[model samples]
Target: MSFGAQVLGTLGGIVVATLGGTLVYGAIRLTVGLRLDQEDEYNGADLSIHKISATPERESLG
Candidate 1:
């Protein structure tokens, strides 16, 4: 193959790989976000690891 054709092919491959990776990452993030949202709605906090308040009052600095 010609040098130009090889370079173009390499670039195309890289672009496709990057897009696929980005899509996978986005899908994972969306799934996680949805699960978390559902947990918040049903249980008020994430319970996979431990049960804790989603919001706790913090000491104010005055």
Candidate 2:
């Protein structure tokens, strides 16, 4: 009903959401893991998954 109450409610919602998301991701990391392996990390995600560089650069002055 008041501007101050609205702001406080929004801030509280954000804090709860952030903590909930962190807990979910932490559980997943502990069980399945979340990252690229050595070779994949070295090669980069685009080259590994899409078979192309994320940013292609032409070396010509045309």
Candidate 3:
């Protein structure tokens, strides 16, 4: 393909990806949820959700 065609194709692909991501994120946000609360976030997912740290030796980041 020509250079112009390649460029257009790349741009089109990027637009499609962006739109798809936005839609998926919007749906998820409307549904259950996307993120954790302040305390859970500070504790991290491994501890907050699983009740155990992935790295036992090192403490939580916060």
Candidate 4:
């Protein structure tokens, strides 16, 4: 396959895999009844799910 075709093919494969995985995951999440009552709405997934902040408070950084 040509270089362009190869890149396009790779991207196409990635897109398909990502979309399929997302659908499967969504269905599982729906069945399991896992909801994110995110206390750290401003903060993000790292702090919310992992219980560890990726970035320390600015004062702590100083």
Candidate 5:
């Protein structure tokens, strides 16, 4: 309840969250992967992942 206690709690929370996020991200990167290939990036996520265009009519106009 005191100011010192509140500050300490906030710092502890930040440290815990940062470490937890780093571990989870590292695990995913080592396993299923985290980044897309160049073709996936250029074609876009909507087409690569979902196998469909997000806006086919509008895209054709350009």
Candidate 6:
């Protein structure tokens, strides 16, 4: 292959790899955020952190 062709091929490979990595990272971050939101909902983080309680009997430890 010519030198120009080799350089282009290398650049293309790099671009594709970078895009793939970005997509994977975004997916992982989204999944983690959703899971954290679910946990916060279940454990009542708002009550503990923000002093807002759905149940009046629950008190903020902070």
Q: Model 6 reaches what TM-score against the true structure? A: 0.51
Model 4: pairs clashing at backbone N, Cα or C within 3 Å: none
The CA-based lDDT of model 4 is what? 0.82
Better of 3 and 4 by TM-score: 3
Order the candidates by TM-score, highest first — what do you get? 5, 3, 2, 1, 6, 4
Per-model TM against the reference:
0.52, 0.57, 0.68, 0.51, 0.83, 0.51
lDDT: worst 10-residue window of model 1: 53-62
lDDT per residue as tens, model 1, 1-62: 89999999999999999999999989998776534555556875544436765555473233
The sequence of per-residue lDDT tens digits that candidate 4 reaches over residues 1-62 is 69999999999999999999999989988887455565666677787879887877985678
Report the lDDT tens digits of candidate 5 across residue range 22-58: 9999999999899789999999999999999878888
Q: Which stretches of candidate 2 lie over 4 Å from their true place?
A: 40-62
Best by TM-score: 5
Clashes of each: 0, 0, 0, 0, 0, 0
- Tens digit of lDDT per residue, candidate 3, span 1-62? 89999999999999999999999999999997899899999989988989987775646353
Query: Candidate 3: lDDT over CA atoms?
Result: 0.91
**Relative to the unseen true structure, what is the C-alpha lDDT of residue 21 in candidate 1, on a scale of 0 to 100?**
95
Candidate 2 lDDT tens digits, 1-62: 99999999999999999999999999999997798789989989998878988775664333
Better of 1 and 3 by lDDT: 3
5 or 6, greater by lDDT? 5
Every candidate's lDDT: 0.73, 0.89, 0.91, 0.82, 0.94, 0.77
lDDT of 4 at 5: 98
For model 2, the local distance difference test gives 0.89
Q: For model 5, which pairs clash?
A: none
